[model samples]
Target: MGEKSEANSVAPSARGSLHEHHHHHITPLKEKKFRWRVTDEHSPPEIYNWTLYLSVFVFGILGSARGYDEGNISGTVAQTSFIKEFGLKSASLTATQQANLKSNITSMVQLGSIGGCILAMYTVDRFGRIRTLQGVCVLWIIAAIIQCTSHSVGQLYAGRLIEGFAIGQTTTIGPTYLSEVAPKAIRGLCGCIFAGAVYFGIMLAYFANYGTALHVVGRNQWVIPTTIKCVLAFLILVGSTIVCVESPRWYMKIGNPEMAAKNLSKIRNLPVDHPYILSEIADINEQVNLEKHETEGTTIISMIKEIVMTKSIRYPFFAIAFMAQVLGQWSGANAITIYSPQLMSLVGITGVKSLEMTAVLGVVKFVSAYLAAFFLIDFLGRRRSLYIGISIQLITILYFAIFLTVVPQAAEKGAVLTHSQDMAGKAALAALFLSGTGWTMGFNSIQYLLGSELFPLRIRSFAQSLVMVIHFANQYGNSKALPKMLLAMNNFGAFYFFVGVMAISLCWVYFFIPEVSGRSLESIEEIFSLPWYVIGRRGAELCPDHSEVNRVSYNVEGTGNAHGGDIDYETKPTAEFVENASNEGLMKSDSQSLEK
Candidate 1:
């Protein structure tokens, strides 16, 4: 404890010395060029190598596990074979009973996810991200086998419930791993791969379900999709075991500085003692040291007090992540995703055609997610990207609300549509696709991206675990009640509710959430020192933009080779850049969005 506390005090001078040495050694190499460079050249080009990209990509694939579960269940429940095999096709069942049965089947997974999330709170910190996910893969495999061979409704429910454990854990662990491993330069791009995979996973499940329904028969129909889910889980397990390295930040938190340096070096593809590796480890230690001084003890109650009462330390990080989940879940994206078939049918596209349309909607969502990750989140900045996505959602949802009001098709029972109404229904169908795009680009990415990035490393696992608990809770509640909410609120009222929530989300975001696209994780801690109410509006202005810092570019070797007279550059470590940012105009991070 004393050592970590003392470590922070030495970083500035140590970094300053290292910066001057590197500047004198390599600054003259202006005419030299490397094979590749991080687009902004904020980081050593080595950090952007194939090893880092592939590692993050493989870890990112875990998002598909959650996506598959969400997508598969929606279509799986609609399977004729599944319905008949599970006795859900009974003619004697009343409408309410049928709704209750389907809700039970769908929501049991969420109930189990709540348990898995609680477990992740401990295991992610205890076992590390890679191992926790490996354990998750094993649990999911067990669940998948149980689901595949189930002969009765009770067994099916049990299998689904058990599978939720893996889903719950994956949701917490996936983004955390991505954020830790990603270089700050492409953190938004890399972190977003996890979000993008959700869309891909959904698309895969929808396509799988569609293919099975059209081509397969008997118990095999549901079993085949279940098998696909199992295979994906297995693939993730193999990737974790064979490809990815342990999160170096997790190692630093656990007091394994040697291992932390080694792993960070591995991920960055630099030498174990590279200056960047040493500096990063120091930066991470500074964050840990800072967090330690803020709290009184390691007890649960003490932790709670720090998060809730401190108001300046953990509170903003905690609250930002927490509210992002709450607002995101209520934005009605998941509900729309799970009920795409029913909603599509409401617009007069029925039978297997509804399933087909839902799958296409999944494609729209997947494409939008990629667009946000690859281009918007880092380029437009987090706040601006969200605004763009919300604008799209607002327009689409309002169109839906107005169309439902005018048509009154879903609000009434056995109402035959007039010619104009039928044409308008088609347009509503198109609007639903548009809504999928907006939701993916905005709420879905925010929930995963911000939830992972907002917290300090010390509380990240617990924070994310708590967030996922809320996440699955919302998912469970919506999955169970939305079937009923659709009936009780009337279809249009439900969308109207989402419309109100979205408007509030926009305003709340503007007033309470800061633009955080280009800030370092360690630097983020300083932002909360401001009054909470203004943090969102003022936070972006507080941190430095490292990528914009004028630095001599390094060559294929970690630092540039000795050359002619030094090119114009400053000698300061990224950490010192953070302090400079507070007093000067700016200091550090790896994106241009901060320049805005």
Candidate 2:
């Protein structure tokens, strides 16, 4: 895949002119001017404009809408009035019945999300990213309205399932859209924003729940949160339609390269002929062409077969994509997010205290996700971030196991916790806080980032849908079974299960995941095309030789002459170079001239 080819070398004078003229536009200072203004030491800056940032911001809020739905129900279900109003607290209900009802209320969202993921798989590619998002935003609003006005349990369940479907779509598409449009230099950070938005939504839901619980005296406690989510959904609906631009890749995939180029130019605030803009388009075309060549028939079954059966593509690409979600879901992150109040009560912190603490957990998660998006992801790089964060999560879950073992009574939900039990409860809360932080820093965000980058454009939406289906399946199963697990094995046993799962996850990541911090989307394809065994420990070092393929050079003199000039050039290769150099020996004569 990294093999070089031959092409004609331009004359020295013409080549020098091309190099010098293009040089001014690709400089470090010029690149920094285009980069998103964020304080991070590790990530090199690249070109970005307000159009791209605005689109990303809107998508971030879309993610927050998903988070709001997930987090709001946690607090809503905890309300005394909500429980009584819905017969969840009725004396006729057995312990088993109550647990089932609580599970249904939360797990239904996962069911809805699964449906949404399937819907997005078809629509995102057919209707384009922005259009699909707009359609789902309307669905979300309808679901919210149904929830706000529900008079019975059946109606509430119906509303929640609908809401989940929309969220599921948004969660998958938002990151997909952002990944397709973001600059390579800050792609990880941009993807992290979607994850951070989820935490942000969770935080807002917690605060709303806490405030409503204290101030509102009736069923309105739950109703207000539902209504707020509805308003948010409406805003997203309007904004997505009016503000967001269509993904350029979607246009290119549909064979509308002209429109794709136009949108790309608009997003980058550059002319269609600008080297960066041209390079991005060429890169997309190169990847698309590769996919076309590999899967000639291009049917659903064939794509799956190509991804699963082909060794060169499967192990490092599809398998890694699938496991990224597995690690995230199996890490017990969603178990904690959906059941924080119940989890807290098991550790002897019940009543309003539990609600307050859940809100604080939300704050911690939001802050951690925010920090990871702006500072940690680009700084630590994706591979190291996943390792360190998962390790922290493992340690925190281990703490939970130990705390529950030492204070067995604390594992009994609704028990009147003693002073020591209270101390143990605080410890458990701290551990939960740490776990949430760890998840946001790595697994929570990196899963989406990797998913967006791993699959070829031909199968990206479908592949993401497949992964999301697995993700939501894990979430649904976990949400429904967690309450029962706590009852059967005690809180200690549950944490012990998660601890073991995370430990294995740590090893899997260390052995399989590769570093893709600053690489371009097209270049990522070449990295995966390498031998699978070589991808583990030194994957970043072994990536397809990008030196000449995408390398761009600049001259300080701003003149066409290469002699007696102070030159500043980027080793980063362009898409045209990558494609042209594939002709065998294209680099033979110009290799020295191309060198800085």
Candidate 3:
């Protein structure tokens, strides 16, 4: 941790002249030499920028509810009150009921997410991120209203479908909104909220379920849980309506430069003449120019094709898509989140005593996820966290698999067994806590950050939309297959299956996922150079500067192969890189001269 902090401390000054002479360069320190304030950090406090913090907080709250809803359902059903009230009691009613509830809830939510994601992608620039977030919060309210009045299972499913759309939209746009608005130093951590909120939601659900089910919440039991979720979602809607600000970058993209500059200053808590603010505005202008060219000649389909066909673009896609899903999911993380109680039972953790142990596991998950959020943007950076987290995940799952193997009875008899071996079971419980700890370290935090960072600004929304679609598909598949896999193959089969996937995923990550820890979204070319094959072979050591930092070829020659050759870490490229006329006219001037 100290090592990374030291490296970052050296970053800003380390490359002082790297691109300082570019066409558009601004330094507030030189231009506003006489005008100084005593702010500790670069930006002002939230009090002065209360509107911005309020906006982010509101979205965070709304987003958190969606996560809570998704996570809570399993534990909610596990409650005796829910099982009894919902008629999920009889052996005949169990399988079909469980599958139906799972499918109806998850599918509806995911399907809505697909719509929400699509809408956000097209309309974000038009309506703005804050507006979209505020607007989508309405879906949560409507879903809540319908759920509160639901008389049948069918009605609940309808509500879930509506809620799903809102959740999908939130996932697609929320991270980008946070990333663009946050300071560069904390951007990774800011983006980490997308996943952190989900885990927080899980924690909320766990505690809420325990509070209402275990404690006394009155006669109309499940009503309190459902109603509380509804109210929280509604409050998010109201709060966002009152306080959220539109993204400044989104404003610049749509030709509202004045408002963009104004909002940027407001959100960033900067003086109008701040140097970093000037850089931000310059970057926005660059983006605007790029967008203008795009409007004249590009179609979304063509853009998608260009990205896929372009070797540089395809590499990040392969890395993120493979790692985000495979490493994140292959760890059997979701199973623990969605089906821990049942899993505990399978592994012989049952009765009141077992529930207490599971509670400890939940707390560990909560604490570890919090640790991830703290380290994610600040200490580990994005790619570093993924590397360390994913590596740990591989090791833990292997051990988990081994643990399941050794305790063969955990498979055949279920986790809830007779008390003949209480001491042995206690040891097993400790192991379970360790497994949960491992999961939160990498699995919980990596998903959202990787999804958000793996694409360029132009295609971020679309890429994340596609990523979420796969995410829910996998969720659906796992939810459907898991119980049966557990019962049929028993715990051993389930563990082995996930271990196989994790092994393959680790290889993909080792080979492909680039270190994007602290780079700007505009600087994605670095990642583009890392092909899946290379990532498999070299890991982060590929970058001449830092193994994790990806690089791009700005060389007009189009043949320098910044991404292709054995990485030249020992020597640096010369400055007099000539433009290659033979290169396609699509090449930009800044192509070569990309620095270490």
Candidate 4:
């Protein structure tokens, strides 16, 4: 605890430029320069160079495996050829039966993903981050082969389940590797890249299917997209071997500090003895040491017991895991992402137009998620971003829900709709587009961000695995529920249920999430240590002052904020950094902390 405290505290610095020009060269201090606002801000530009990026991309690209399905599955199953090849169009099958079959095909991957996530819980640590992803990549290729060559429905389900297993492992490993390998300050940037790849895969798949639907005919329509999955998996598998490096922290975790330093120096383009390398290793060791001390023997049951037994860890874990299902999955975003083509069909838009709109939805989801991490979350702060995003979702989805409830199409379709009905239907499509934007900015970003932000080191693996499992389970449940719900009530029932939950989610967000933007890895423990009721509104204010003081917390005044929030710290430094600093007390008004 003493060491963790020292890691987050920064002394005022009035002398120096943040390091620039790299490799064993600690260039002589410049003639004159302004002080560093915070410690991690002292990072060298060398850390941002080519080697770091290549390594991040090698693992980050794995997100595409999960995302490709989100975009392509709807379009793939919608194809004329796929429909006939699987007897989906047969007069013998009822509409409900056809919907059931399509739901199974779309959701089998999600079901498989749940199992894979469970497996990843074991592999991620045992096999290590890089090797786990390598194994999953190979598994994905096998899954893709089955997916592309399937002649029977049973075969397709088998392939998708296998594919889901691999994708689950990839997502689990990708972010873990990105966080561990990238320089601490730029870890946020790498996370955005991972997310962008997911959406990019979705967007590319959407457009590809839209193109194939128009340009190609016959069984080749679905075959091309399935084959594309294999190509993507192959690329990731090859990139890992050629480009990625083992995480330095992983070496430390396994009790090889010397090897950890070796890898850290290579990653940072610094000598093993460089001050930066030593400090980073110390921080990793502190956390790793803490993790081992607390968990002792790491196991799922033990990890769960660790959280349940500790109030500080328990509150945050339960808070986030609940949100993963409520705000993340059941809030209707995944349903919309997975079943969008069908939703478009519901609004009197079918065939080519439905596929095209699905393509557009992909564009909206990809752009908003990618940009929000960099812009929205930083500019708006975590809590407000969720508020504004949910507001957008509330308005758009409510309008769309009302449209469905009041429409003639809600009852039974007439041959031709009145002009007013047609215009209202167009508005409904726009509502979906806007709703998707709202979801990405609000729920999607926050959910992923909190998974990384809120937990202590010891409980991180179990908490993440649990969160991910719920996420996929919700996705699978929603996929099955939508078709059944629409069959039971009107289509609007699901959205009404979603809107009601979202409205509740808004209140929940206000009373739960704190301003997590600029808090360091160590200080997060202080914030979550508070009682649950106050953690949301006052946690940041009440916790130890570790934020980079230069950042503005909100727009309350035009002048610079007294408490600025920088990006969250990727690692916590050791006592050596704090003791060595010139304590002008920058953290006090010289930078004084706000202590409760």
Tell me, by TM-score, which candidate is best.
Answer: 2
TM-score of each: 0.86, 0.87, 0.76, 0.84
Whichever of 1 and 2 has more TM-score, that candidate is 2
Expressed as tens digits, the lDDT of each residue in 1-596 for candidate 4 is: 44434434432121011111111323343321111211244454445556777888887777788889888887888889998999876889998998888899999999999998888888887888878888888898899889888999999999999998988776667766766675544455465567667777888888888999999999889889878888898888888888777887777777776677777777887665334454555456666776777667666777778778888777777775557565667788878877888888778877887899889989998888777766766556778878988989988999988998888463344447789888898898999999988887788766655665567655555566677787788889988888888777778888888898889888888788887664445447678778888999998888854433222121212111112222222122322122221121111112212110
C-alpha lDDT of all candidate models, in order: 0.74, 0.74, 0.58, 0.71
Give me candidate 3's TM-score against the actual structure.
Answer: 0.76
Model 2 bad stretches (over 4 Å): 1-46, 293-297, 316-318, 411-421, 545-549, 553-596
List ranges where model 3 is wrong by over 4 Å: 1-56, 91-108, 216-219, 295-299, 351-359, 408-421, 529-596
**How big is the positional error of residue 190 in model 1, measured in Å on the Cα after superposition?**
1.8
Q: What is the lDDT of residue 591 in candidate 3?
A: 35
RMSD of each: 7.3, 5.7, 10.8, 8.0
